[model samples]
Target: MNYLRGEFDLCTGCEACLLVCSNRAAGGYNPRLARLKVFRENENLINRPLVCTQCENPFCMHSCPVSAISRAEKTGVVLIDKEKCISCGSCIKACPDQMIRWDKTGKADKCDLCAGNPLCVQYCVPGALKLVKKREVPGK
Candidate 1:
């Protein structure tokens, strides 16, 4: 499994990742519509990028009433099947990190690792975001 990792110390709160992600994910320029969120904490001393960990136990996947969400075995990226999805917003509420957002079609939208080639990672100039192999991450 490969996952997007972010370094808080390296983040500059510039929202470049948000911009590209929003453009790619939502086909718009709104940061509020981005699946990944950056939180400014510690009195604005640091920026923390909150991305979906693609959890070992995915709440979003479990919460889907119509079984719309599933993990890709090859990449370990959780995906939503729009054809099966009913736009119930259950997955959106089930996500603890607020990583899930609404698509233009009123369906759940989330980080799919950009199908293994993330545009957000490319736009992250501060080196805050990078894709980590499964073995590289602990407790995988």
Candidate 2:
């Protein structure tokens, strides 16, 4: 499956990805509301974009009491079903990366990869983000 990857050297700390992601997720331009987060590190020498890697053993999905979270069959994107969610925040708490966010509607929200083409990937400038396929190791 294809997934979004961030390259630190290519990033320019523009935060365009944050703006577009927040707008889609929060219906407003708030970086805090975005699913992914970026941190300016190394004394502002690097901007590190933190995104959900869609883990093989996802804690968020397992911690969800009502099974609201699941991996999409085709995309392998972790998703939250708002209808099934009871706002218990278990999924949020279980995430090691803290990618799960609370939406305005009191439901758990996270990156769905925009169903394929992520707004963050599209808006990311300086070629910091790219959609990549999982590669098979030659030795493996």
- Tens digits of per-residue lDDT, candidate 1, 1-140, equal 88888899999999998899898888889889887999999799989998887887789999999999988776778899989999999998988798988899888888888888888889998989999876532332
Which regions of candidate 2 are displaced past 4 Å? 135-140
Model 1 residue 38 CA deviation (Å) reads 0.7
Error of 1 at 99 (Å): 0.7
Candidate 2 lDDT, tens digit per residue, 57-101?
A: 789998988988887776677789899999999988999789998
Model 1 residue runs over 4 Å out of place are: 135-140
Give the least accurate 10-residue stretch of model 2, judged by summed lDDT. Answer: 131-140
Best by lDDT: 1
